[model samples]
Target: MPTTQHSPQGHGHAHSLAQGHALDRSEAKDSTENGGEAGNMPNLSTLSLDELKQLDRDPEFFDDFIEEMSVVQHLNEELDSMMNQVENISRENESKGSHLVELKRRLSDDYTALKTLGEKCDQLNKKYLKKSEEYAPQHMRELLQIAASNADADCDRHVEHFLNGKIDVQTFLNTYQSSKKISAERKAKEERLGTQLSALERAGI
Candidate 1:
């Protein structure tokens, strides 16, 4: 029996041919799956050693392959440029989202502060209005009028006491004169305040 020996170069050549055949079969299957239309062809860089070797023997195929490789290279560069733009847009959108969130937080804080301030203002206004009412000119006039009326009533009671022989003449006169002065003064003050309040109302103060 005789044994056959294979050279390294022959083995490599056979392997390359096998790879080319497999690639062709794959392209044929892809085309069939795509309704028998030729799909995207593989890049020249992915060509088998056997296919590359054909460049030396076929000048027309070589030129066409070179042109196709150039188109593929241009398309790859454009795709890379587009991908970079997409990445930049994504980063910008993320930054904008963060900024918008911060703005919303600040707005909420401002609204809370404004609400607190408004509540405080309302409290102060109510307090001021209560104080104003207590010390109002019309209220003071009413108090004075009440005091004047009480003085007149006391004088009338003292007169009755004198007439009933419950008080001396001098004591009754002294009390009567003092009560009259007080009543007159209070009446005068009440009239003055009333006049001032009327003027204020007329002027829309």
Candidate 2:
């Protein structure tokens, strides 16, 4: 007869182990079908601090544990390097954003200034045109009329031949003829001056 062992606790433990294995297999199959990314396993990250403490205190496992210490140190250094790179990139992007805002502000200011300058120039031009229309030809006409009158006065005074003594009929008749010629020339000058004033007034400038 073969001896058989029977214990309720051992049977329960074997059943629990079998169930755990089955659940692990099913989860792995689902993960593979979904092409899931590498994620921390719950069993790994959930290790109790007490469990790690106990392991560290064990003398027989010390050498083996410390053998992997350098690898952990190197991994920490790599993590630090990646974090620095990320921070640097973030700072550069922030600076670029600030620069872009400043440029936009300056451009807006320049556009506003240009618009104001254009409006001012238009107003000044209108003022200049209005003043020019009121003043130019009036001065020119006054100058021309004054010059013609002065010429007439000079001619009338000079025709007498300085006669402070008695004069003959030949001298008086010659002086009268010369005065008549000068009067006609003065009349022509007066007419031409009027014509020039009319032309300047009509032209509006």
Error of 1 at 116 (Å): 1.8
Clashing pairs for predicted structure model 1, backbone only: none
Off by more than 4 A, model 1: 1-68, 143-205
lDDT of 1 at 74: 74
Q: Which candidate leads the pack in lDDT?
A: 1
TM-score of 2: 0.37
Candidate 1 TM-score, true structure as reference = 0.43
List model 2 lDDT by residue over 138-177, tens digit each.
5544544565566555445444443543556577566666
Residue 28's lDDT in candidate 2: 89
lDDT of 1 by residue, 5-106 (tens): 999999999999999999999998886797522224535567788888998789998877865754566787899999999999999999999999999999
Backbone atom clashes (below 3 Å) for every candidate: 0, 0
Give TM per candidate: 0.43, 0.37
Say what the RMSD of model 1 is.
17.1
